[model samples]
Target: MSSLPITLSAMDTEVRVSLCPSCDRSISCTTTVFPAAEDFQPPQDHSSEAHGTDDASPLSRARRAKHQACAIKSEIARLKSLTKELKAHHRSLVELSKQQLALVAPVQQLPVELLHEIFLHACADEEIMLRTIPYTILSAMSFSRVCRTWRNIALNDSRLWTFSTIIDLSALASAYSRPRGSWIGWDEVSTFKRLVSLYLSRSGCRPLGSLNISASYNEPALKAAVDEEPKLLPPSIFKHFHRFRDISLTNSVIKWAELRVRASQESLVKSVKIVGHNEPDMSTVLFSGAAHLTSWSQYVDDFVPVNLPLSQLTRIVTGWISYIPAFTALTQCRALKRLELSLYREFTMEEDLCEPEILELPHLVSFRLCVDNPCILDDILDILDTPCLKKLKLSWAPYSGVDARLTDDFSDWEWPKDEFSRFMDETKCKLESFTLEDLCIPPGVEVELRKQLPQSTRIVVEENSGWSDEEDLDLDDLMSEISKSDSESA
Candidate 1:
């Protein structure tokens, strides 16, 4: 039989008593129950009612909820405190990483000297560097950003920071050829100043050995390049110019006033090569500025002038020019040791009436003459008197209608054989080597000219210097060999 469920009072639930002791003495019972859970009014919370701590009153249930809310609030405060501590630990770890980086950086592990050399190599060579007007950003500056140690070393070494200025022909064309009255930005100029500042501050007292300032352009590739490239650059950029050994500029004209300032400041520069400049009036200022120049390459204009400091020059190279200027210029170079001249086609029968004034270069040694016409060559040699001349090279460039040699044919032209013979006799110099290229000379005339010089003079001809065609080889191998010999002897 199913007995009706009995509800236990709160006191009976806590303390058990034998109410059915007379019926069954062996039966044991659990002390917790509240009317078999169906007596509770609330639909949920059977766990509270069945556990014998029954909160059947609304006031009792409210008090139990208040206690649970306080516990949850305490737990939230603990979690927030823990989270704050963890963040502080994370910040400390970040500081530790910075310290570790200093010890582990690769450059810090190497000696300072090796790193210095590596830094030097990272800087680009002056000759091949492009867009150098402002700076080579990635070339030298990249190494400085690797680490703090690297930055210090790179910044301290001045040699790595030296830069040669470059004038890009294409960019110059675009910059200068803008519409009239348009503003030009000083982007390139600013870049040059920053580079100069960084290099000078770091270099201390080290001399910048060499620099190249050039207007680079391919004339045949674009007409715009030739027309738009500036004839002369402003001298303001080079105002701080000082101690340098070599300065080479090509294909652009420059201010004579700026050159005068540079020459006055830099007296020890050994060489200056100015090629294809438009102005020849200021050539006097160029030589005057660089009073110690030993090597000079003058191709300033198609027609060169003669007012220059030839007294200090030991070497001189000229581009294609007529006979008169070459003769006038060579007359003053008393200290010249080596000379190379490029001659154009010029002839004058009137040269007979006025015997050209002869120039005596007592210390002259090596002379290389490249000519297109034989008469022009004869005209140059008649006036130059060199007593100490040793090495000589005569390069004949092939030209149309100029093929006829003055063997016996004087009907059309004049030969300065007597004038050349006279100059040779006056110098009385022992010629170590004489090189002739690209033209045939009669056997008798060759032997007679050789007899006038020292017996040891080696006469080289076109057939000997490995040239199947002169136009194909501009190097002139015979002259190259003679230059090598001169260098070795020196």
Candidate 2:
């Protein structure tokens, strides 16, 4: 028989149960039925007619949402706290990195002795030092930037006190005094002051070894300094006579009187070089400044007027205008071992008169003469009086009549046979090497010159005025063929 549908008939309570068919186990659940009409009285079975009780109450749903909102708020607070902590940690790390960098940066620590050794190295290889390393080191100011220890070491290092020989003293002073300098301007000034004081205290400027001042583009700053503030630089800067060993100046407008006044105090300046567009009037101050100059290179509008009684002077190199007079003035330099002359725009026929009687350099071991005219060689060979002359280089262009000024025929020119033969005989024992470039000689000349040699002399003859490329192999072939013929004949 089919079970009849049952409905609860209680006033306010109701219950329902379903049974599993196999086990007869009852599964409990609840449901409520509600009145459909709005204006109805309680139904007879009120337990089944409570419609609102079947759905979740608004208060219960609201309670569950409140709990979920609280949970989400807690999660957001936790994330914000974590983010703040991470930021704090990153800031600390950055600060620590900065501290570490400050602590570990490389610093110069060379002592005075070590610095002196370094300076010695620099002095030995002046080209490399001036061209590369010193500029690089000074450019970075690395020594100045390190901690107090390095700064102190660098400041106290006397080698650091030295400046480039080619530098402008005025510019250097200005840079040292500028407000925005790497080191405080006062600090640089103080350092320079201390160095000057130290150098001056010991025998005035005796400790001041070398001074070089130069300016280009016609800047008048240094000259102004010398003139206006002769006292600004330590009188020791000029007054200490006899300590300096070298002096070089170029394109300078300083007066000779001032130079002599300054140099009179320096007893030891031995090497001097003066160069510029216009030569200084050095005649009056020549021997007055220093009598011990061993090496001199200068350019004068006229000949060197003053004779320097330089007994120790061993080398003389000059460019332009007054070489004959300059050589005559160098007669006192009996110890001179080398002579170099660069004839720039020959000024007179007097220059072509290279007479041994007038210019005698008996001790010269090496001689170099650079000129355009080959005819000058005749005069030069006649005047070569040095029995000790070992090397002779003549850079000249033969008269190929290439220039309209030259003649194709030079047969009419007579050789000074007596003077030439005497010079050859005198130089034969000493001349060990000869270099001739852009030169031409009659075929018999070379053989006769070689026969006069006391010992084997190495002669190099470069024929063409222009350099020949490797593809021009005809000369090489001719040399090879000549060598073969010589071997077969031998």
Candidate 3:
């Protein structure tokens, strides 16, 4: 190992060509020879003799030494000067490479349209960000700070600015309830309105994606909470109602009157979701005439508002709608293809009471009705008919939302199977799917019911699992325990 390193070290150094004296072998090797080695001698110092200072005084000797030192110092200074220039040259070469490479960067070559798409994708969670962050432009503003080009592109691309705003309930309520005469209160109101204006202007007349407004505080739990909702966006914002495509309002997110204002606009609204306790008056239509509406969700409890273009709607979802309102709104949906309803179903003895002129949803492919009362099924099936219905899902729940165990002696809870069979036969609709969830059904009846349906129909019966089993105790064993305990006590 020692000789191997020495051979490699010599080969790497400058080489020489020579003939070996002993064996006449050609040798090519470089030798490291010092000036003080056997073959070399340095010249003797003769500076003192030439200067005639061999017998000089102590001061003269010291002066000669100082002169020698000065010459050595000058040599070092000259070498350092060369080093500084070399360092600067190396730095310039490194920077030059960086500059040349940047000219061919992929990001630099990306077209503006492509770059705009990247920015939109970067803020894909626009709705989530709005829900969590107070500022609407924070995502845009953050991206803009990246570079001047991104700033220009993000600001000009109206699609990048289509966003949702989530305002806290308390702050929203106070913005309206407080007097604007006070500077502090006025500042808040103006600040909120300005935020809305900024969004509208940046969107550049593009179609607004969605407006999701929610209350910050729990209005039901607060003490002396204001009933008024802060119109987060000013009235001027609504002037561009044609831009709105999706809107969701919750918990008095906006005053009921604001909804009416939105209803009056000839907006190109396609989907709407409303969830609140205070129902708008039944007379006031949701969207006075929404021609473009195709999907709607109505989750209010009290009263159903009218304004929707029900005939143009294809999908409808409602929450706890009673018999009258359900019939009223559903009957108007001439184009309804999918219907989901949760109802406070209370049937009357006067089954003849008008049930909205037999809702004929010829286009309905899926129909799901949730009723707590068992009798409500008869009411619904009697008047409503969907000829093209491919899926029918029915959920039978109790008014308390829970039911006790099914027992042998319980009252007859079997829904009139014959009535359902007759209804399907009359509609002339061949169902492809059917689901019965959380209901009490007699044993073996599921198989019998399946036999009656069309061969193409897929049926599922989900029994009330919580209450299906009955614990039968033997009377002999129970009596023995009772008698034994009684005798011991006596």
Candidate 4:
């Protein structure tokens, strides 16, 4: 609180004094002037004269200054480089985002049902390659290239590969499962494993309709599937073998012997046609599942085989006719309506001595005789003695340069006209149908033969006008034309 002394010298000195201690020069200020106190110490004065001009301190200061300058410059350069990198990174990110958006936009427009139809078409035709479908659709290419949604759809469609319609077994084995090039050696295990995996995957998939495992050497896998789980072989697979309807194979898959054991269990199997080396020793239980069987054609290699009791058989074609001594053995088949002789060799010198007894099956409605040579008329009349016989089909080729009288080696044995008429009358007009093919009849005899078949709807008689002694005639075209004409007439 005591009044302090205010001097003019202090004011003037303070006004002149500098506040900046680090700077080289003093700054001007407008304020009340006060003289600096003598006791108050001032910053130390550093002048060029205080230090010598030739002192090493100057060089050291320059070195320090250069180091500081370089540090500052380096920091600035780093900042610029970082800025350029950041700009480049931002531009790339923007471009990538645009491309992603472009790819995603097109896929959203496709309908789910359209994709389903493509899968269906692929199942219908096995030959169609998956890539042929549109990119927007679910194809192998689209699934790989496009987004995840399409890939899921394509991979899920199991029917895509199930319809392996390949006819050639070797080609199919090499295509999907086996190695590309020729496989040599015992290292085929890999191929087998791959095939099993492929088939297993397909079997698990739904809607697989038809399958043909009839190709060669695949019988093991096929028979195993049928034997182990007959249900796996859907009815549709059997229905696909339209051309092979008349044929059956029960033995080759495993052995007709083994098949007889599994026959009752195979409810899916309608009919099976097979040729056995020996007569089947199995009981009729093998035929239990084949309740739907209407026809059976069996060829046994044994001299005499056991007769099959076909309950529902409407037609029976056998190769043992020549082996049977007489027709008495064939009458055992109660359901026999049609009989086809597989080894019916026309009257030969070796066989003529042991002529088989004429088979007169009372229930026989149709008879089919396949002959390598012309058969005698009396042999046919003996078979036609069955009153139920309505149709007769003969498969034979007429001999070249054979007269209508049948005097040549291929001539059909001729009986008197009265005897032939008597045999026809004895049949009681039961023979309503007759079929003859690949033969030449004399011009006048053709008309007479037609008159003999009074009730026949099928008449196939061809006059061999081209038969000559020098060159053998190609009867293929003529036979084909005759068949066509007969078929049209029928």
Candidate 5:
């Protein structure tokens, strides 16, 4: 066979060859027309004429076809290697372009001051900071890992590390119940303690934003640690107590005694929340020198005496106190701007009891009252005179015992409409917001209550007793705004 001509085109890049044999006309074929190895078929015969006599026999043709296929496969493999190299080069160029573009990104061009503010905003989520244990430190570390500039900024600016730190020792306590040599591995506990130390050190001289420590009293882990090992919390943490701004200790009674001992030194603490089965003594005056203490909250089973500087407080939330004691406590909180009280059980009405003297709270702007019995609500409202009150929230949960004969359901109970109206008129206060939770008032009564307040006042009433599901006003935000305004005015 002899080759006549070869043709090529841009659209079809494959090389086309024309062949002319001694006894045949011209035939055209492309390089890609060669059959793959699996598709190729060999002659079945092995006679002398097929193999040796004629060069154009089936055996000779098969051998030529096999040789051609081998050569084509070698060429195809070389081309594949070249294609792969080209693709790798293309990817490198793309990555280089992306890096160049990132260098001139708008965020990268922002001034350090603006970037600092943006970072603070990113870490301003208080709920996440409070709920997730050690997340405050983890979040700061994450910001530092972004880039060199971020790392420099995050490490230098102490505000990023000032989020509320919540250390929960309940898990550690549970881990101690195992066999003798197997306490929850010390590596984990050590790592956590190290993180806490690192977090505090990065805060510099700035006041600690908040510190929340919770552990159970029933767990012997804490007491055992105090006796036999180093404390679960690093000793360095207590050294910074004077700089603590907000503090919460729950369940562990020993921590309460520690705070009482350091009360005079905690001059920077602004808020304190305590929750437990029992606390130190009723007569013990904790935080005696905390002049900045403006908020106090306690959750206990019964009414316990407390000797705080109530005259200077701006916020107070008490748990389960009798009406007489609650009223007496309010009379001392003359500077209070916000007050919340939870009264449990029934109040005995004695005929010999004299009329309660009216208590006036001139600076009060917000009040929330939650009672299990509705019978004493009228008497409570009659005695309170809040001239500056702007927000009011009333929650009712009917007691379900044989002695609590007030009412089984809120719908059957009578609302103190006349008493509340008379109180409003007597105080001459303009309420900007009002809320009634867990009280299934009739539609008609709701309309009347709405009419008593200003038309612009925001009113919320949950009739089905599912108030927790609804979005109520955030009192903390309100009080913060008020405090800010007060400071600006001062």
Candidate 6:
């Protein structure tokens, strides 16, 4: 084998190595011994020497030194190339070792059934499941991308694909304004529709837990597209209407009317919520075919007329309605177990053409009312009768004179104790829990009210008047007094 020779030299405590062409083995030399100063000889002047003489001329020596330097540089380049190859080989070996270790990893050894259960739990994390636009699909996609095993598990599990699906068609409306030839082309709407179709298909035959669809065509930019394609949702969505358990429609009046007309009688829908403004006459009764619907919620800027199977409903939550209409709706819900209402106006002269009769809800177990006018609550208490009432929550609406009611001493405020006492006596229903929210009540009055209720009943008094427990002077003392009264009552 041919080997490149190496020469090592030391001078003034510095060492250097270079290739030696004259020898096969490496040569080493050290300049530890130095001549005495007096015997030291200076370099000879070779400028006057002839180039052909036995001694080398200065130019010849310079050329020889240059050749030596070039040889050293060539050797250095070869060694560097060799070093790079070695490093790459080392990296490959390390990666191979890691792969071997991973084969024996504890997590990789877990049974496929255990891994599937673990993945299910991970998908159900509150942080992932409770998002405004839920990340359930995104999380499942991520898990499937991890490895083949996980991909098969996630894709085959129908439960992973049946969470709430929120379709915001307003996004489609905004897409029309994008500059021409942008990322979202004219076919963007069809692409989104296909995506929704695919998402629903992935759910297989599982019931969709909730479907929230919101769309608004009020934007002037969408007028042309609206004329071209009146419907933003894919027709495939309606085919799955029988799978929906809860449906929420916001500002989608036209779509809502269509859905009500096309809803399957076999729909598993149990809850319905509608939120909109200036809704057109939806002469079509809402959810008339949903025999399983037990809960209804409505929020509207204006009073949109609604006709549904009210007798079948067990829960109703409504925002801001006139007193007469509120009472009229309650009368129809004989099976209602829970009722929540926010009354905006008292009875008008036209609405109260006849004397108000008692509104009886025999099956009502819970009642929550928020009134803008305190007198409205007084009227409700006068006419309301709930024989099975167990929970009652009353609060002042935001528009009510809450600021005026909040006082340091609550000396100017007094709860309608007489009306409440009369209602309690008339209903003859034992209340299990009573809550008073956003109301300023004198400590003495609170004590008196506590004395009237059974000791076993739970009473919660919340005053959101910016007064902390410590700032409320003598609140702890009043609480002790309440305890004493409870003991006496017992």
lDDT of 6 at 111: 90
* Candidate 1 residue lDDT tens string, 303-415: 56444567788998887776666666777788999888887667553653365476678898999987766666666676678888899888766333355543223234343
Candidate 4 local lDDT, 198-285, one digit each (tens): 4335434343322223334444444344343332222233322321222344344324234334332433233345444553553334
Question: Which candidate achieves the best lDDT against the true structure?
Answer: 5
lDDT of 2: 0.51
User: What digit string (tens of lDDT, one per residue) describes model 5 on residues 417-483?
Assistant: 9889999899999998888776655445666766687876777765434434555433334445667
- Which is superior by TM-score, 1 or 4? 1
- Taking all chains together, each candidate's TM-score versus the true structure is 0.56, 0.54, 0.65, 0.43, 0.61, 0.62
lDDT-based ranking: 5, 6, 3, 1, 2, 4
lDDT of 5 at 13: 41
The C-alpha stretches of model 3 lying farther than 4 A from their native spots are 1-104, 116-125, 128-148, 170-197, 216-242, 256-264, 279-286, 348-356, 400-413, 463-490
Task: Output the worst ten-in-a-row residue range by lDDT, candidate 6.
Answer: 126-135
What value of lDDT does candidate 6 attain over all alpha carbons?
0.65
User: Between 4 and 6, whose lDDT is larger?
Assistant: 6
Winner on lDDT between 2 and 3 is 3
Candidate RMSDs in order: 18.0, 19.6, 15.8, 20.1, 15.5, 12.2
Candidate 6, pairs of clashing residues: none
Task: Give the Å shift of residue 20 in candidate 1.
Answer: 73
lDDT over C-alpha atoms for residue 79 of model 1 = 41
Superposed by TM-score, candidate 4 places the C-alpha of residue 53 at a distance from the truth, in angstroms, of 18
lDDT of each: 0.59, 0.51, 0.62, 0.45, 0.67, 0.65
Quantify how close model 3 is to the true structure by its C-alpha RMSD in Å. Answer: 15.8
lDDT-wise, the better of 1 and 5 is 5
lDDT of 2 at 351: 43
